[model samples]
Target chain A: MHLAEGVLPVEWAAVWFAPAAATTVIGVRKLRSKTTQIPQRKALTGIMGASVFAISLMPIPVPVAGSVSHPCGTPLAAIVLGPFVSVVVAAVSLLFQALFFAHGGLSTWGANIVSEGVAGSLVGAGVFLGSRRLGLSLFASGFLAGFIGDLSVYAVTALELSLGLFGVSELGRQWVSLFGAFLPVQGPLALGRRCSPVGS
Target chain B: MSLRRIATVLVFVAVVAAAVTPTALHRGKGAGDYVGIDESIMEARAQEAGREARPPFINTDQGDLLLFVFTVGGLLAGGALGYLGRMVFVEGATSRERTRSMVDGR
Candidate 1:
């Protein structure tokens, strides 16, 4: 789920934006360096970008949480692409969602990117690589990556929201409350993401 | 069993589990609820600080119009990003070969 516009204080929003911008630039450079080596990198990035856009739009209701959230396809994208490229894809998709669908917010774009793009992709990639190093099959590794990646996004998002809303003093308590609320739906969604063909 | 087969079975089971879950049970606060929470908190904070909450820059009420603009904008942006990325990154022999093929009109 995306944090809406005007939800965060201007300073907090700017804080998130700076890092997102830095990481995006880094990702772009990485992509440029890899393009010559990978034959279908461009096509794959485009396809994954579009897929991230579409998949994020499909909201699945989580019965126990009394809430609905969509699966973040970033982990799968990170697996196919790399973490940097996945960030680009996520930024593009989240931008569209914020602008066109009102699903996310313009001011909150940086925060969303940090949570869904950078953190999600990096965590997913790290987990995937770690799993592979453990001699796990590709499918199993991908599953773990997708599952962890999906959950991490929400976890980070919870922290961001709590920080913005409650400030530093009550940050921990607020984050835990919000994160707990998200778990019921996020858990099942993570599992579904892990098991999906794209995730594996 | 092959890893692929195991993955497929896992996927099937997950799908079934998701399908069987009742929508009513999941019918709690949506993301919008969080936004509301932020608004209230910010307002309280503003009151404590003796300041006003910052307003949004854009007209958030124009949902439909924004969606249309964003859709068109997103597609163009994504396409342009992809194209530019290809130009900058995909160079050297493969690019030369593709260019030669096109130039030959074959």
Candidate 2:
């Protein structure tokens, strides 16, 4: 889901910016309130942030695709910390990845955040909560959340890429192929919870 | 050490070896082998669409620098995760028990 530097056009980048920024602001407010209520949670939040940074950036090779791909870490973060707070964690990690690692570019950071942060977190949290409501055990619910949430990041990325690269006209034709490219590697990784008990 | 601790360490080592060994051995062979899907697939598609990925501002792709950064980052994150585990499972559980006992005594 790393949209490298200059991948998205300026217009598309701007299009992604508004919602990403707004969501991040909401995440910040929510996190502040949470931390304020329980000061000890600060440590856990830091741990989650670090985990997101490491997990999302670590590329594992999948023999099926003969290529490596990163796992989105937002799902597990969302399950443990609230979805909004997970968004903040993802945004911060993505920013660091953009600046230091060059995995994603500054220009396309907003789009990356939207996919990996917003969509991943919401879907993960929703799936986990819904599964629990349906009487699924914690492990079962976590597995579903991680698997679906990981795939959702790439799904959203494909949409962004289609819209940004081909405009609105070719979106219907492009996203499927784009998303398909990710499946070979991501499918198995997501099944393994991206090599952790909880992760995308 | 306890059996669980030994097992955890062994598992961690095995996972690291499994992830790193093949890629390290096959270095400089072919572009496709172990290349990130981001570059092999997504970026390729973007290029076909006439939008190219420019060089990053601080290109960590320079000769094992990316690997070095990942190693350092992994270590720091692992440390934090260890602390998190203790906080949530060890200290937090103990604290809850203490609170329960206090309430029962009252």
Docking class of 1: incorrect
| Chain A TM-score, cand. 2 | 0.97
Local error of candidate 1 at residue A26 (angstroms): 0.7
Model 1: lDDT equals: 0.72
Models 1 onward score TM values of 0.70, 0.86
Give the alpha carbon lDDT tens digit for every residue of B9-102 in model 2. Answer: 6744664454345445544443557889788877888899898899899898788998887788788889988988788779988999999999
Model 1: per-residue lDDT, tens digit, A101-154?
666688889999999998889999999999799777787778778887887888
Model 2 docking category: acceptable
Off by more than 4 A, model 1: B1-106
Worst 10 residues of 2 chain B by lDDT: B21-30
By TM-score, the best candidate is 2
lDDT of 2 by residue, A1-200 (tens): 89999989999998998889999999999999998998767878888898899889988776645678899889999998899999999999999899888799999999999999999999999999997897666766786788789889999999999999998988888998787666666776776664575555
As for candidate 2, its clashing pairs are none
